[model samples]
Target: MTAPGLFVSFEGIDGSGKSTQARLLAETLRARDRDVVLTREPGGSPGAEEIRALVLQGDPDRWSAQTELLLFTAARRDHLERTIRPALAAGRIVICDRFADSTRMYQGLSRGDLRPAVDQLHDLMIGTEPDLTFLIDMDPGQGLARAKSRATAEERFEDFGLDLQTRMRAGFLALAREFPDRIRVIDGNRAKAAVAADVLAVLEAELS
Candidate 1:
């Protein structure tokens, strides 16, 4: 029988080092001779990348919460169809930097009332969830500092200020609780190597 594909996702607030950790995990798994596909949401596929520019650029309010949700779901659908699903079907390990969880956190915070819309849309259009999700948890202050240091046009989301980041951190923690089976919270305030080590430990436990 063909073995099922492994789908892993890394999630965290801006500057929580999720992207770096995701890359490290991908490299480590590859070193072990595993078929790994390291990708990111909102832009994993060509069409999704185009949507990424639209959603991540411009002013913070460039798109309303509802509109942004639609755009994100669109991108996610494309990414899944063009990149994620294909890799998974081939029995490759797929590691995504961010996934639908991000849309839930961001849009849910933008307008607390939009949380339902986000969840409902996800259920309808994006039925798949990650097999494992690593949430790099950290203080919003520290995370904002890290994010500001590497500011770019994509600052639209990061520009939401410290309060929003703090709230989003809470949102993520709540999500971890809600999906305890799939979400693993990692302390991200440590050194990169240390954090990556913890990430590997957690992932290895799952794999083994």
Candidate 2:
């Protein structure tokens, strides 16, 4: 039987390599004969997936900051009930691509409080934080350029504009500051293999 497991998250601005490292880590763990659940926020489950599409489908001209926050929170609640809580209870290591911190960075900081109603929306969702978070950090321009290089098309978050993304990157680092022990900052500009190795080292440490 699987023993009690750990909850870990990878987060960052777009193209900071959160998803790639998360998947790589999961695969590595599986290779080592450990049960690893790889998942993402705002779409880990059916209800959440719908919300995710709303959040990332288009540009800022279509979705407002507050709207994006609500969708994220909505999907998060679904993720909490459908994926995270269940996997943890079943004793499976859970590595999420993004979590509450993403919201705090994308919505909390970039949006500038979002005209007050956003606070209420956040309260309605954005539940407990992760047990451990790997903040894959890099320069905003570098991150965005990486994203563009890898992507065939842009998403809503991608079209958030440069200044907004810079603020979001700062926001992520600031959030990482609040939970120093829980959040580990990784140099995302490193080679993917090097970054994956760093993630593996951190996970091994966390697990041990």
Candidate 3:
């Protein structure tokens, strides 16, 4: 029987460079002859991608915390069914840019005190968690500046400004503390190459 696959996730506030790091890790692993599926949350499947556009574009107030939670859960369910589960079942490494922890922060703590609802919904509708999660920690001010430089349509969350990013950073750190064994915190206030190196080292240690 094929060995079971590993499910990994990268998470941080906007502009924390988790996305870039995720891509870099996927590419490096592929070079080593590992089958890697690099995907993102609120996306990763066709249906989920559509939902991504809905949640990511538009104004910051486009959806309330409760509504956003439902939308995100729906997207995650579809992503799991159509993309993540199949990849892992086939023994392919699935590296996700963001996962449920993002929901726990963005929709759960950032917008309001909906963490319990987030956890309840997560347990009910989406029961899987990444085998390993990297919480890329950085200064919210710097990260927000970096994020706005891209000026992407997915600026809805970034538009919430530095205050939101600050809260998000704290929330992510708290999450890292909560799941100490599974979540590894990495300092992302360095050069991209440096951050990638730390990420690779951590992952290699895990694989070993």
Candidate 4:
């Protein structure tokens, strides 16, 4: 594997607007002449995207605990090899929409013990570490309400009630505790511009 490059990932529940923030960050980086590559997990590569469809299409609650772990790992393996690795090798700033933490939280929803294994896999596949990982935190109920209003499509995980999402939100907070250096938690209850500004503050401190 190549040496590490500047990598950052945005993580949060379904409706925390991770993608929106990621795009804003990417554009800002580009404006500053930083080579930036924006990608997302469970769907970064072609193979991984197919895995995403499978994982998200079914009732996530019904998917066996082990099945959930394997599917996410499978997608992650492909994503790391195909998308994240190359971009970083080129010295690009990779702003990913979501990464291993998503799996840790979602898998935790099913089986808590799967965390150690996921962490190990994450260490293996994630060749580069984010200088900063903005974790958008939101109340599960509010996020789910927003998610329901925005997405017209159906997915297994999308059908989960607010309770599950709430648990997942807590899981993310716990993850930040586990990796304080890389993870920066952002309150997602605020306005979009406010959230964006908060993220930029961290980036400024890091890049300058």
The C-alpha lDDT values of all candidates are: 0.91, 0.81, 0.95, 0.81
Better of 3 and 4 by TM-score: 3
Model 3 C-alpha lDDT versus the unseen true structure: 0.95
Collision pairs in model 1: none
> lDDT tens string, model 4, 66-157?
77788888888888889888888888888888887787888854356677777777677654456678999998888888888876544566
Itemize residue pairs with steric clashes in candidate 2: none
| Tens digit per residue, CA lDDT, model 2, 79-154 | 8899888898888889899987777777777776753454466556654667889999988898887777776444
Whole-model lDDT, model 4:
0.81
Q: RMSD, each candidate, Å?
A: 1.6, 2.7, 1.6, 2.3
**Model 1: per-residue Cα lDDT over 93-114, one tens digit each:** 9999999889889996644668
Task: Report residue 113 deviation for candidate 4 (angstroms).
Answer: 3.5
Residue range 70-163, candidate 3, lDDT tens digits: 9999999999999999999999999999999999999999999999999999999988999999999999999999999997889999999999
Sort order, TM-score high to low: 3, 1, 2, 4
Where is model 1 poorest over a 10-residue stretch in terms of lDDT? 108-117
Could you tell me which 10 consecutive residues in candidate 4 have the lowest summed lDDT? Answer: 151-160
Kindly provide the TM-score of model 3 when superposed on the true structure, using C-alpha atoms: 0.98
